[model samples]
Target: MTATLDQPTAVATGVVVRPWRAVLLRVEGQWTWYRRHWTASLLSSGLQPVLFLAAMGIGFGSQVRPGPLTGGMPYLAYVAPTILVSGLITIAVAEAGLPVLSGFKWKQDYWAVASSPVTPGQLFTAELVWITLRLVLGSVLYLVVTTLVGGWTSAGALLVAPIAILTGAACATPVMAFAATTKGDGHAFAAVNRFVVMPMTLFAGTFFPVDRLPVVVRPLAWISPLWHGNELARGVALGGLRLWPAVGHLAVLVGLLVFGLVLGRRCFRRRLVV
Candidate 1:
């Protein structure tokens, strides 16, 4: 007996199959598209970060004397890891916001994919996975540039890649949830970049310590995922991160990621299922 078109091929062969296989297949499709247009993405995720490091961390850092503001280290060493994570967060926000909106609205590809055997939840997971892969590639490239430029202060900086991905996801998943709820020509995405992403990047202790901010504005940095990520990445790179504090920062990032994942999954289901 042969399996019908609707029947599972693995089941016919007396093998069990996992639902996540569909999610992986969807991620593969995303990868195929990314492979073709990766050069465009490389500009933002890779080259842009390198230029920022060279101009801000190296060139400008040379004129500033190391002090309490820089933790007694060269300004470049003090700022490199934070900038790396910030770049990842920027890329993640862009990928998760407008592109997600396009997938549902302009492209309508989500609906077409949902018409198949894949579930809405699987589609969400696939999107998250694809974003993770992109972040990884970008982080690796950024780290290599940092090393060549002598911006990486410690060997432990190698761990920044995974931490950067976590940081990006913490931001990306929430933005994706917002995108799933939007029904417009993506004007809201511009507002998100302006009002949300830009503020977070500027005030999240990426270029300077959050402590330098006015007392009234300090809370904003404390609540920002980029702040936590910057603290962790800088601590690891500079060899100052304590174990308990590291755990606390990791917990916050993980919490945000979980909350966003749940919210995004629900939003995707509501939008795609009906």
Candidate 2:
């Protein structure tokens, strides 16, 4: 008689591990790698936002006077929160794109881990947890710099951290799902940066009001997670956050997050299981 060992048989024999435990183990592995090689991430995710704020908010802002355009605040204060959110979205794109593709295709790390007891859903969850950690750390650093550079207008600006994290996760999860479906040398990721990331950063109310955009193009901003995040962050930071509007913005971000999680899990399962 020949016998085969598998997860189902292991579970029957009382060797089951909890799902969250598996997810945490994967997250720990990611953290271990990141701890050893976090400098590049720090450069893009931490320092880049500060450079953007200095250049756009202080440098060019010096030439422009605040008025209806700035929502009646200093340009630095007006643009700071949105810039933070946009920067996170950019980080999300980078994290969720090539790295995700590499896990499945170039590196085949997902397959190697799948040969263990870890499931695809756990892997997807761990990826999200790691991305969220990056967003949280980046947001904190950006907020600290914003406060130091006189970009913060209210104590409520502190709330931007959560908003930025949500915005990043919303962007990251969907891109992670897309990356799972991609093949080749990750050329699609470049197109994503050019078409999706750049458009969202430039037109999604990051640097200016969406209403300032051409009427035909305004809908693009409305669909952007960055725009929703920007609105929430600016409202709380600069004051004047209306109840219904805040709820609506939260709903949009939450919807995107839920949608991405669903799609990302399905994609991970499809790729890893088969």
Candidate 3:
């Protein structure tokens, strides 16, 4: 007998029995979509860090003298770790915003996923895991470019990958939760970039130290996750981090991740399981 037009052509994998497996399957779906359009993504994602490094760390850095502002290090090396962290934040913002809303409002793949036995929390976890994976891979590439550009100074620079990933995750989770809650068009995403991401990138020590900011507004930088991540990256790469400060920076990232995850799971359920 021939199957009807409504019948699924592929063989069934059956219900995903384990929670971990369900989450992995959802991540696999994300990977499949990425694999198809990876070339276009590479043009933007791959070249961005390289271009940023060349511009800010090389060209602009040449004009900057090594001084107290730069901790006696060349501006290139001084800014590279922070630039790496900032790049991850850029990518995280791009991924966590419109694409997440699209999964719900436009493409509606999320609704299809919701029909499955997978819980909304697992779906949220998979998205976070995928974003983390992107940060991990991007960090490796950015570090390589940093080395090639002479921006790498210490052997400890290798540690910047985890620091950058944590920083990116801290930013991404909350943005994803916000995206899931937004009901309108791309305007909301644009606003996120304009208001949230842009301000943080400019003021969160990506190019210079936050201490340069006026004392009255310095607390704003202190509360920024990017600033904390940048500090950790710069400290490890340049070798000046005190033990207590490192712990404090870590606590902030972990706290943000947990808070975002709680909100994200709730938002996903509200949107998808409706």
Give the candidate number with the greatest lDDT.
2
Q: Which stretches of model 1 miss by more than 4 angstroms?
A: 1-17
Q: Over 4 Å off in model 3, which ranges?
A: 1-16
lDDT of 1 by residue, 1-274 (tens): 3456668555334443356898898988988887898777777556666778888899988998899898898999998998888888888988898899999988889999887778888899889988888888888888888888888777889888889889998899999999999988889888988988789888989888888899999998898899899989999888879999899999999999999999999999999987
lDDT of 3 by residue, 3-29 (tens): 587787886677565888988999898
Which model, 1 or 2, shows the larger TM-score? 2
On the 0 to 100 scale, the lDDT of residue 31 in model 2 is 90
lDDT of 2: 0.88
In candidate 2, residue 86 scores what lDDT? 90
lDDT of 1 at 233: 92
Give the TM-scores of the predictions, in the order they appear.
0.91, 0.93, 0.92
Candidate 1, lDDT over the whole model: 0.87
Q: For model 1, state the Cα shift of residue 206 in Å.
A: 1.2
Error of 1 at 109 (Å): 0.9
TM-score of 3: 0.92
